[model samples]
Target: MDDLARLVATEDVRRVMARYVYSADHHRWDDLAALFLPDAPFIASTVDGSVQARMTGRDDIAGQLKARNHPDSVLVHHLFSSEIDFESEDSATGVWAMEDIVTRPAGEPAGMHGYGHYRVRFTRLDGRWLIAELRITRLRLDWTY
Candidate 1:
């Protein structure tokens, strides 16, 4: 890729990362769906090995995530240092070190908590960037700390 194309692709990849965190933290299910390909595979798991779930396709992702996080009182997914490694203009992968905090309003025993790391892959489809695969890994769990 040329200088301008690479720059644009990098910027687009960053926006994709930002949108994922923003949509999840804000509970914008519809908006989140737009960030992925129609048939993308989304995987999320806990670093502690308590939860490991996978959802395929955009519809499933929005539905499943909405159900899982609806009752949460506060959830914020913050992503940073999201650098993309591209094989070409059409494909790339990124590693985003994330810090997420969740607060339960229902007074659950878990209390307010924080977790870490989101490794992601991106694919350019029909001139747009989409998250093809995602893996969430927790580096630390505040509930245990």
Candidate 2:
């Protein structure tokens, strides 16, 4: 890819990542699922290396996220320092520093705040960039009771 093309692709990938965070925090499950490929794989794990969940396909991803971030929950995700590397005209990989705060309803546990990084693979499908693979690794977590 040309310099300009590569730059544009990088920016597009960044936008996709931003959209993913926005949709997830806002409980926009359908929009969140649309940010990924139909058969994409998603894995989330804790800092200590325990697997939180593993999901394949957009439908499953959306369902799982909905279950985790329910109606009585409030989530906020902040992404920073994203580095995107283009491997080809249609493919790239990126890592992002992230922090998230989640709060449940009054009767539930107080809340959770976590810091992490997201490693992802992006694919340009049908002229649009989409997440093909994603794994979130936590660096730290704090809970309030």
Candidate 3:
């Protein structure tokens, strides 16, 4: 692809990443699920390299996220410094610096603040960019009770 096409594709992928954060934080489960490939792999791990959750397929991924951010929970995700590289016209990879805060109900534990990097693979399916693989590696996590 030409420079212009590549730029456009990169922007599209960035938009999708932003949408992922927005949808999750807003509890838009259906919208978030639509951002991934049908059978995508989603893995999340901590700073010590311990896996937190490993899920395959959009439905499972969405369900897991929803469960974490329930009705009495507030989730905020911030992403920055994204590095996206195109592998082909329809495929790319990216790594983004991220931070998230989760606040639970008053009766429960306070919640957690985390910093991480999200490594992801993107594929264009049916003319829309979708996440094919996602791995989140946390750099730090702090909890409050």
Structural similarity to truth (TM-score) of each candidate: 0.87, 0.95, 0.95
Q: On lDDT, who's better, 1 or 2?
A: 2
- What lDDT tens digits, residue by residue, belong to model 3 across residues 4-35? 99999999999999999999788898798889
lDDT of 2 by residue, 18-63 (tens): 8998898889998999898999999989889899799999999999
In terms of TM-score, which candidate is stronger, 1 or 3? 3
Q: Residue by residue across 61-106, what tens digits does model 1's lDDT show?
A: 9898777664655777777777678888899998888888776655
Model 3, position 110: C-alpha lDDT score: 63
Task: Show where candidate 1 strays beyond 4 Å.
Answer: 48-51, 107-112
Query: All candidates' lDDT scores?
Result: 0.79, 0.91, 0.91
